[model samples]
Target: MQEIFSAILGDQLGPFGPLILMGTLGAVLILFTLPVLLKKKQDPLDRLRDQIKTSKDVANGKAPARLRYDNQKGARLEKYSAFLEPQDEEEYSAAQLKMIQAGYRSKNAVRMFHFAQFAMGLGALALGLIYALLKSAQQDMSPKSLVLTVLLPGVIGYMAPKYWVTRRIEARKEEIVNGFPDSLDLMLVCVEAGQSLDQAIIRVAVEIRAGFPALADEYEIVSHEIKAGKDKSVVLKDMAERCGVPDVASFVTVLIQSQQFGTSIADALRIYAAEMRDKRVMRAEEAANKLPTKMTLATMMLTVPPLLIILIGPSVYDIYTLLNETNF
Candidate 1:
């Protein structure tokens, strides 16, 4: 009965082997091709929306008509606008929407990044399957072995992109955080110069371009949204949330409160900027203090072992020589 069953299974898989191979290849091809197809379908809608938005902005005196129409020589502004849409729109507040617009150049790039991850996973699985088949051709292949060899690589490949995205987000957030204090200082200067809060934010965004490009980009978005007639408090709050940083959120909260109570914007900015700088300094000091502790394990593993090897080596070698000379 077992032999009969085995024979039946072998016969079924034999004729279908070529078909299975073809299907697997087709699946991988589709895995790569589908994203491109979907992006093509989606691009027109994105472009139309951006054009409408730009037109509205120009009509409202939010952005100059020239700014909307002026393209770098040979540049496709429509394509650029479509590419600049925010990723994870639902996750952003109005302020955050501005920041995302300013900071990330391509929303489609984000989507393509995710798609590339999936393609890599599929490719890894295909490679594993190919390797397994080739190896099996030279030896016996068990079901368990086949599953491990093929599936492991696929799973690892699939996870790589997710891990990469998470790391990138963290690194970007840190970059923004590191630049925040300087941006705040610039805002304070603008406020002191008699600019209104919104105007100050725009100026800071412009002024900090050379030094803190990421924060400048975020500020540019805030300026754009304000120009579009969004409520000031709402935009600030949204910006804080989108930034996903405690310091920026605290600063935004201060701005919102100051705006609500008609407090001095310059004073608020000055105080917050000082506090941020102090916190940054303390953080650096704390990190410096921890370095000795961090080095302790390495010191023991590296320094102590080398010292021991130097101190004990001659005695051990002499004993070995003496023992050898005396015979076993």
Candidate 2:
């Protein structure tokens, strides 16, 4: 039976084959989301009927209701989330902020994140089991190889969520850095039009919501924080920190200084706006300068080798044929 099992599962497919198989299993587990999403999505007609029902209730002086969610699913998620919750206060806050930076900020976002982390760890372990079994069959089925193969992927699976979240934070920070100059320009225009800084932020958020939503969301949050009795300078500083943009930090600094010294905000904003525009232009020129060097490397990798082969192969073949005809 062991021989039969080994023969069927252990065909040699090179060093990368087991790894590819494990990756395929991980990908298959990810597809579980498709069924959940498809199941939860209501038909257009069903949604329309729900909307009509809510409208009629509002017309009849009754409160309109929100869509019903599955309590059992929520409970299960919360349970799994608690299983993976961070123990340290700082770690918990950092995790929450990372999720927010990744554009998840609902009340349940933290819970959902922890749940996903748990799911991925289990999925990785299962994939590692199959990979380990396959590898053991193909080669020496030792305890050490089994332990090494299973343990490595299991550890990677446990840390994958953190890695993905870190990537999202960096990507979000880059967007803020790239789009912030325009957002600053828009807010400057609003400030010059005699709007208060708070009002300017609100207006800018509306204006740039489609083009620069990440920055707009920060602005929107600032507006809400101010309305909710937070100090404007503190909120602005917090936003800059959360965005992780040096330009935004400088912009916030100027705004805070202007407010403190009773300076003309319009003047302050105008000067900063010009500086941001110049910085953006310089960044573009720098990227353009690097393009040629990058393309040179790409040409060497993708073009030069092919050309060399094409130019040399026919001559080499001709020389061989000539030598053969001369009976050399």
**Candidate whose lDDT is highest:** 2
lDDT tens digits, residue span 1-328, model 1: 4455446445333333344456567877986775455453457889999899998998888975354443342243234333333445674344234334334444344444445566688889888887876666566666687778888998999888667666755766887888898888888887898888788888888887887676777788788999999998888887776677889889989988888898888889899999999998998999999999999999899999889899999999999999999996
Give the lowest summed-lDDT range of ten residues in model 2.
33-42
What stretches of model 2 exceed 4 Å from their correct place? Answer: 1-83, 130-156, 310-328
Model 1 residue 298 lDDT score: 90
TM-score of each: 0.69, 0.68
For candidate 1, the 10 contiguous residues with the lowest summed lDDT are 73-82
State residue 181's C-alpha deviation in candidate 2, in Å.
1.2
lDDT of 2 by residue, 5-38 (tens): 3465555633444554556577577667644543
